[model samples]
Target: MPQMFRHRGFTGRIRRNYPMKKILKWTGIGVLAFAIVIIAALLIIPMFVDIQDYKPRLETMVSEKTGRDFAIGGDLELSLFPWAGISFSDLRLGNPPGYREKIFLSIESFDVRVKLLPLISKDIQVKRFVIEGPHLVLEKSSDGKGNWEEFGERREPEKKTATETQQEPRADMLPVKTLQVEECAIKNGTVAWIDDAAGTRNTLSELNLDLQNVSLDKPVDISLSANLDGRPLSMKGFLGPVGEKPGTGPLAFDLALSALDQLNLTVKGKVTDAATAPRFDAAFDLSPFSPRKLLDSFSVPFPVKTADPGVLNKIAAKGSITGSTEKISVNNGRLNMDDSAISFTVDAGEFQKPVLSFNMEVDSIDLDRYMPPPAEEAEAASKPKKKPDPEAGIDYGPLRKPVINGTVQIKNLTFSEARVSDLSIKISAKGGRYNIEPIELAAYEGTLKAGAILNVQKDTPSASAELNIMGMKINPLLQDVIDKDFLDGTLKAQMSIAFTGDEPNAIKKTLGGSGELLFEDGAVVGIDMAGMVRNVTASFGLSDKPGEKPRTDFSELIAPFTIKNGVVNTSGTTMKSPLLRLVVTGNANLVTETLDMRVEPKVVGTLKGQGDTKERSGLAVPILISGTFSEPKFKPDLKGIVTQGLKLPKTEDLKKALPGGDEIQKESLKDSAKDLLKGLPLKKK
Candidate 1:
């Protein structure tokens, strides 16, 4: 019974297996037949079908659809075997009616090959794509319409409602699942742009572009070279090793660019969520190059003529930059120019009411090198001064909107024949108020500490400053600044000043300040005090400073001053020297640049050290100084000599009446009498 049951089960299995095998065989046969028929159709259609015969209908259809004349001047070839491809020559597209040049675009030849099977998966794999000897023209008519304007109809774009715009992305967010190209190239393409109204014509010619390893999953190498308006330009780059979902994830790029063979640059970057909310981080490096040479390559003049021809040569920079829709940051930034280098970082955002911040450090720089060379003496003298333009005035409204903060430190800086060391500056601004705080620098054996504020909240801006200088050498400072060294001393000074308005002349007229200046162990060059004292009437003026450059040596000089409404007043400025004592009082008119001063001088017969305050034993000659600062006049106060209490007191009365009546005081009085009478041609009583 067991053997019989086994036999039946085996038969049952065979029965089921036979039908399954037969069904599989029939399915295979049907698939092979379909494939064979497709292959045959692909091979036979091109051979038997004369696609050119339908060119007129095809051209007519295209012309009607595109609203432009289209034609194929040469035979069209088609292939469908390993690569589905088409090749044609002498294709032309015409512009709309009324154009002088009817042909808008023309091509010598175009060929393309694409894999057909990939289309089923919504993917494109381009086997080969090539274009050769294509030409295009963009012409602007007198009415300002271009040949490339709207093709078939002037239809406004369909505007979506707010709700529609905010809708979720459709399933077909991307045009294709993936794109891959084995090779693509364009050669000898040209484009011409003509503007009839402007009477200008420009052309881009000899354009070549090539791409390799082009795939969504792999980096694509691209290169292009072209000539633009007779200037050469080239670009080579690699884009993407993109994520599986292109435009949703990271994409990387590296590019090198050059123009006129003079400027060379490289850029590397990455972008995330490129399609939705793109964020990018990039690095840019500029190779050492001459900016002057770059401009010259394009037959453009350098912006300014510099004192040193080589100043702007050899500049290089590298920086890392990152940006989003609302924010931008630059880090690891470095700039190199010849021997100078700077490191910096910057951040900016909120452009509507702009906010900007930066920190920078520079090793050394010479600004004078970049300044324009001095004009010729004769040319400068002959050039007419420009009249003030009433319309050219400051618009401080823009300053009121933005907020800015910055700090800069320079180890060494040189400009205008002056050198500074260890300079640091901090600045901030908001709502039309600007502040510069802790501005410190060292120059000419001196250190300066200063701060300033500018308020433009109102129509007329106002400014104020506080500055202090410590132990600075005046001779070298003046020599470097004005090429003059009429004063030699170590100076200490402090000032606080304020003014309104931005114009220099207006500011000077409105300036108000208080300051004190002290000079130690110095000489007033070009002045002779002893000669003035000896012959007061013969040379009453004593030239204040003779052209021969005689000088008066002083141990200490002090001046304290105040300014109001553009006038400076100094009530007591004192100078002590071995042979003279001088006191000066003056009001200097800053608006008119004039001086009104009184100087009292005393010649000492028995000189005392600067520290001693012995009685005055000398002839006093009061003098007046008046004129503009540029050409001051000095004269003795003859009226004062005739007026104030010079009625001679008897020698006994002078001794008893003077304060203290000390023996030294009495002797000084007697010596004054003897000297005045003996020195002058007067007889002694």
Candidate 2:
């Protein structure tokens, strides 16, 4: 019994010690085996697993996928410390057939380091990815085919063999649990675009892009810089976590762009989908700069040269835009140029051919300053050259585009010497035609309303307008429009005019219209109809006092006129006053600016407002007004006066002219003597 107890105690101790010894021995063996394998791999694996030997396979795979030839001129390199990295040098991608450029893409080198342990969990964790000296060319042929689109062609799938199909179904590749990129950089890159159809070649050089901490679940910060067409541009922003599909993520960006002139712009925006059809809300600020200088910097010619140099300078704008692929909206848009301010809003649809609806307001604008000086224009026009046809240079191509509907209001607008206030215009365009309806404005102490239609569908562009003017002061209007105040009155006028031409002279020459004018309590300055008539009748000749400025005051003047082929004809333009009544019948040639008019003046019985004058009746005088607009001449109608004089007989010769003249005269004398005696006696029966 004692011996059995001792053996049991020894067996219990042996059990505890044997368990610890077995664990220690196995642990040592595992350590030794792991070390040996690692050492063997580090020393021997590279010799057998040559990456260059796989270059042909890699090239073949890329060629099959892209339908283009791909080649690696330099060897492939691999590294194993810290992380597994693969690097390639001098890679070239060939362009498709019919392209002039052989190579579409070429890279000096590309390096990528990946965390090897993440593969066990089916996670793609990249420590760093770098690209250096990459040159990419994009070209579009004359037939509108682009080289970039060649790779997108669909290819038929390879059918599985019967043996492969009979094999057991392979286990599923594990889903990616995590995808992280510590850093990615592209440096010294160049992109060039060649468009044979447009005859344009543009290049972007010195392109550098960097991304830090790019991951599937965290925001990635990005910085980009490039020289575009010799202009430096920079961008920096953050993008939110990427989703399963491209462009399905939150994005924020800021960009700064500047040109050689004082042109600078800053843009800030947030995009919901950045890769595909992005929806973005963006705000932009443009610094005050000269448009002329900016255009010159881009080697673009400016069509207009303002008379005042400062007119086109100091242009700036601030606005916000929101849009998707199909539609866009602009809000709170403001443009400032010199002393003018304009605010507008626009909603547009159909990005390819936009149809726009807009509303805009302008505080004030002086368009005269932006126009060429009159003297300069005149000088240019006087040069010896063949005149171009009126319709030769009219380009109606823009009218074929999408339609626009809008309204524009201006508080004050000045063009040349004409000033308009409280102007509002409703405009619409469609089918190669534009209409400006309900154009209302206040001008010359009066209200004017008009509508105009321009049709570009016709071979020769044509325009028609209808205008109404009410209660306008004629003196100020004439002073501004013609630089002369020929009359003063409250005037009302209405007209409908149509012309078919593309040049100013042609339009005036082709004008055809009719209108009526009425003036109340006005005076016609620079000429006196009554005095001219009296002088011409008395002397039967033209007579004028030297240095005398005569004016005719009238209670009312009414003129109804018609125009045909640039000639204005008035049948009977009448002017009524206390002293005289005058009628004018004439035609004025607008093209030649010449007047051929006849004026007839009739004297009334007595002048109520003037000093007592003998009653003058049965006296009519005809005068002729014939001259250019700048220099007019007034003269008596000598031929008509001579004819009237010859038709009338003298009073002393009336007995011979009429048979009963002598007898009537004797009877009249006897009756007059009897009446005189009766009046002296003061007797009546």
Candidate 3:
């Protein structure tokens, strides 16, 4: 029993101290020593390497890749620790030989760091990349050649024999599958662009960029800040994973941009085939922006001034865009400018010479805010300036743009003192000719329908319009359009007018058209024809008293007029009242705003009838109205009144009223008969 126990203990001890355990322990010690030695070598090797000796090779490699001369003016640095990295200082690359600029790109310092663990797996994982103080110059020569274009000679691959081509295995040129950058930063960058042909030079400075988690498998956050033409700009965005095939992958993104404190924009979307033929559905928001401030920040001048300084300040828009490289469409677009709100859709075709179609509706817009101030207008008018020739200062340049087809509808529109509601206009243009047809509006208690054609293809642009105004109040309509209230009534009118000029004054001077005006239960406000007749007769010692206060109230007034060379002529204008009738013949010069009219007034016998009477008891007077439309002079023709007042009595009245007139008349008649008979018979004898 004692011997068996001793043998079992011996076997157990042997089993405890096995050969595999000893081998594994020694192998671990060797691996530790080797790792230490390797680490020590990595730390010491850079000290003796003298990286400057490799400068020529590095420069040559860069030059070959870029097709330009490259140099490292300062030292090259290397570090070996948790990661390996190489850094360069004072590096410059020269432009193509013939370019006017000496250097294409220059960097004060550049650094790249790679994780050591990834190197074992043949995967390049950059820990950090930094570039400081880089300046790039881009130039375009007078001959339209750009400095960045490829200028180096290319070597074509030698053609392979058919047998060799079959023998070669198909393989990708670059086999690296995984690439990642954890962080990247660029600071104090500058870019300059020169266009010799255009004689323009532009520079951007103080540029900075920062990136985090830059990889193909996760979202990358990026931030950029720059100074563009003295304006500060900033952007922040996140881009979705780029995937294995970077350009063709679907991407989701969100970006925000701010410029000079004047504009702010945000865009969020998903894009497919991001880098080539990208198709995207995106939502964009731009708000709290000022167009005027943007222009001012860029040192650009504004062409017009508004009455309210804030009128163009608060512009905002929200919309969705769907597009590819060749086409883009904006849908559900909502815009707000000051007090106006507009919704629209725009489809643009043919990206080069874009054909645009738009449909828009505005809730309300007060155009008066965008017009010149009244004080400025009055001051301009008060200045002593030469009368301008209207035809000399007109420009038709805006008509030469690409075609535009659109429809615009406005619920309410206000201009100066005029208010219009429910206004709609259809517009189309092609080849310098534009048509604004089916323009309908509700204004001044009536409806106005008009269409206009403007042909700017000629040296002098020609405009034609046809208008129909129905059941309009003449007083307010005239006051709004022409600042005159010459008549008051409900009016129905139609006009077809045309003019050949681009300037307002020239068009007025060249106006030619014909129209008819019909006013019912209206009155001429400025002067009374009946009052003038009565006053003239009473003054000439022929009538009782002047008629009532200087207004001619008529039950109906009708005038059919023709316009020629800016002059409006009416041959027969008739006005009928309860107690009087008037006929007016006149010519009004629209350009000069002058009136030359003759008014003949007659008193009617019956108060409630529409027939002419030959009663001679009432006075007849002819009045002359001449002067400007604003201030006209009404005068009676005294010679005509006196001639009319000295008329003889009728033949019957004279014969009946005379004393012994019957006997004298019989004797005179007998003598006249005898004389006539004797003359006829005596000629025969």
Candidate 4:
């Protein structure tokens, strides 16, 4: 038994120890040697492989599939261990038939490196990927087809049935579990659009891009610089932490972009569910810059001629936008144009027939500044004027689709010679009809409340308005509108009008409405009753009449009118005062802008403190006004005054009525009244 034990030796003890440590050590050494050999073979074998020998086969294979010539003109190099990589230079893809250019795409150099071990598990860890001097040309063939079209097998892709399409899963997540990239760059790449038929060529060239620290779980820094049609453009940004599953989660981005060295924009945003239903919230800022200089840099003329040359010189905007596939909203929006600033908010959806709601407010705006100046009369007359082109009827089809609800407020607004403050307009539109409800403004020491409706459902669009103006100073209003005043009053008016068409002449001809205007304690300039009575006495020396001004005063005046078929008729216009009572009836043609009116003044009221008895009677001295609105001609009705005064019972009674005038003096008053009716003739005195 002792000898048997001695022979067995340490075998029993080795079994007891289990020998696991030695087995593991030898297994590790073997693995290390095997790995070293494999790595060495990978590093050294490629040195003699001469991958160029396969280039012809690759080219032929690609050309056969694409139906285009392909070639590699430079050596291909490969590296293994440290990083697995391939690099090549001077690769070209030939254009399709009927193109003048021989090559459609050409790459000067390309290189990519990745971790090989991770690729075995289908995960890519890119170390360096670079493309240099890669140029792509998009050319239109003589047949109007693009050179880049109809590539690969000339067969349409299989169309999936509804069931199959619904069952197929979209590739929102990459095949790899993770992606890590250290460096990625595209250097001096270019794309060109050439159309020989149109004699045009546009190129985006010198495109250099770099991406830093790109990973599925970490933000990537990106910088890009390029020239678009000879204009410089650059962008730098941070994007993503795209997560392990791209297009499945939110992506955050912040970027700054500059174009043409004139405009700079910054964007910060987050996007979610990008592959299916993308939703985004973003803030955008555009730094102040000169729009004129930017357009000039592009060699493009300004789009509109403006009265003020300094306008549109600087413009900027900032806003926040939130949107999904179904809806979009803009909030906290600010826009600056020259000296004007506006803030607004907007929400929109239903892109096919858009529905929109918005609120906009402007601190101040001068519409006249943006409008083209009127031509001087001399210049307009000297130019050989062409007959105006016939105006085309407006197309209301587009208006029928959009639904709008909005309000606009302007603190100060100026148009032409008029200036208004606190202008507020609430607007709504749907189905071809639009309403501006309760438009309110302040002007000329008065408040104007108005509303308008525009209906485009008819072939000829129609519009109507209702207006109320209260406590207005007509002198200032007239002075602002015409730069002169012929009358003074405190005006109160209510007006309603309906009109068809969109031109001044058309509106005037089609206008129909009713309105009433009241003037309190006002004067009708250029017509003086007292002056006319005194003129006859002074001429005949019946009595030396004191000098009187050429004016007619009234305590209260009312002019009520109705308009139809472009003619304005007023039968109820009357004036009352302590001295005289006046009645006026008139027809004014809006289309022709002419006036035919009659006025009768009576000095029948008992002239208190005039040394006269209460036996006052009604008398009439008629006047006629007939002329264009711009130049009215006025004359006294001499036949009624002169011949009627002769029929009086006595010249003494007539003299008492005429403020110390005899029968001859009364006849002279008739002649002088004619001279008094003309505003210009009496103004010289």
State model 3's lDDT.
Answer: 0.78
Tens digit per residue, CA lDDT, model 1, 187-301:
9999999998887787889999999988778898989999988889899999987645778877899999997777789999999887878799999999888888877875678
lDDT: worst 10-residue window of model 4: 676-685
Sorted on TM-score, highest at the top, how do the candidates line up? 1, 4, 2, 3
lDDT of 2 by residue, 1-685 (tens): 8899999999999998998999999999999999778767855776678889889999999998898999999989887644778899999999999887889999999999997656777688898899999999999999999999959468799898999877844322225667888879999999999998888887899999999878767677878888877877666766655644435566666666664447688888778856656799999999899887767776777878777866786799999999988899999999998999999999999755569899999999988888997778878877776778644686777675768899999999988678999999999988779999989999888989999999898767888899898988888876776566568788888888888887767776989999888898898775555554443322221232347555678889999899888888999899997778988899988778777988777777677557767664444556676666655544445465577672332444323223244555444323321221222211211
Let me know the TM-score candidate 3 reaches against the reference structure.
0.69
Better of 1 and 3 by TM-score: 1
The residue-by-residue lDDT of candidate 3 on 1-685, one tens digit each, is 7888899999888898897799899999999999999888888989878888989998999988888989999989887866899998999999987778999999999999998766877687898899999999999999999998885766799999999998775332233457789779999999999999988887889999999878778888989999887788899999887666666768889999998878799999989886657799999999768788788877777667778666887799999999888778999999998788999999887666567789999999989889887788878877886777755765666565658799999999988668899999999987788999999999888889999999988778898999898888877866775566457788888889999976556887889999888888887764544443443333122223235434568888888888988899999888887667878898988788777988777776554444545442345556666766655544455555567773433445334223344665444333321221122111210
RMSD of 4: 7.5
Task: Give the Cα-based TM-score of candidate 1 against the true structure.
Answer: 0.79
- For each candidate, how many residue pairs have backbone atoms clashing (under 3 Å)? 0, 0, 0, 0
Q: Which prediction has more favorable TM-score, 3 or 4?
A: 4
Tens-digit lDDT track for model 4 on 1-685?
9888976876787776678878889999999999999988988888878888888999999999999999989988888876899999999999977798899999999999999877878788998899999999999965688987888877778998999988786868477788888789999999999998887787899999999978888999999999989999999999999987789899999999999888999999999989878999999999999989988986778987788878999999999999999999999999998888999999999988899999999999999889775654346556775554466666788888889999999999988778899999999999989999989999988889999999988767899999999988877776776565456788889999999986667888999999999988788664455334222233223343347635667788899999997899999698886677778898988888777888766665476686766644444446667776655555445565676672222444345335344566555544444443342222211
Minimal lDDT window, size 10, model 2: 676-685
Candidate 1 stretches with Cα past 4 Å from truth are: 1-107, 134-156, 161-178, 190-205, 226-237, 258-261, 376-393, 537-548, 602-605, 609-618, 646-685
Model 2 lDDT, full chain set: 0.77
Q: What is the lDDT of residue 39 in candidate 4?
A: 83
